[model samples]
Target: MNPGSEVVVTLRRATAPDARPAADVWLRSFAAALPTVVSPRSADEVRDYFRDVVVPLREIWVADAGDDGGGVVGLMVINGDELSQLYLEPDWRGRGLGDRFVELAKERSPVGLELWTFQVNKPAHRFYERHGFVAVEFTDGSGNEEREPDVRYVWEPKP
Candidate 1:
């Protein structure tokens, strides 16, 4: 697809078969977005986590591009009021897919939502801020698996 062109995708609840491809999107997105942070788990471990835990238990959604034969281009996981995970294919960035994922997250949890992103990810900060989230907390890498300093953002529906 050409840059800045509108790409179509269907967002739907992930099925058992979507686990691996969703994990691949997550892996690729993570690598591209946070090249400096070291991940605690290996690629195989991430895939296993998606298959065994995320797909089975979480409110996970995948942006499927199968209509155009692009497979799964992005994935989002919402856990309660937390937008636990949101990742898109590197090539799919700037195409508004992330905005769509955040919109779905808000629709799923209209009361509010919270998420954490590493401090180094400026693009993520801007993205979430644009979607109405405010940075509410900052920590010095004490409480996360990656031990990377991070910021917490929260969004509550307008009164």
Candidate 2:
């Protein structure tokens, strides 16, 4: 295997230890992807945020690679029948790792799934729609009263 040429991204269940690294990658990518996106707390704050939000969730998964160059490249946080978080590093966005991550999460989901996104995030809204998700509800983000209006989307995997 040649080094420094390509990344080998793979999907696996996220672990407690993965929370910090995942949060780091997620914070950087999310802020970059959505500049208007509310910035994350300081690094210390983000550490606890990930631990609380992602560490205890059994349904979440992380995209990692064996290369030392490879790390937690992407992540998804699903709960009950909803996918609450889906993010990938900006550099890794077009290679379809995100799609594969979605497919894997769907496979594990016994029932249909739902997610929320700000309507202003048109790219995400379109991606979910193109992947067969339907808008099911309107909501707010993390209790932010001033946030752009948001919509909930649901996807039913082929049985």
- Candidate number with greatest TM-score: 1
The residue pairs in collision within model 1 are: none
lDDT of 2 at 71: 82
Each prediction's TM-score versus the true structure: 0.95, 0.84
Q: Write the per-residue lDDT of candidate 1 for residues 30-89, one digit (tens) a residue.
A: 999999999999999999999999999999999988745488999999999999999999
lDDT of 2 by residue, 29-106 (tens): 768767776653676787787888666744778889765646888888888787888988787787898789778767
lDDT of each: 0.95, 0.79
- Cα displacement (angstroms), candidate 1, residue 133, comes to 0.4
Candidate 2 stretches greater than 4 Å from native = 1-5, 140-146
lDDT of 1 at 119: 100
Candidate 1, residue 60: lDDT: 100
Ten-residue region with minimum lDDT total, candidate 2? 139-148
Off by over 4 Å in 1: 1-7
lDDT top scorer: 1
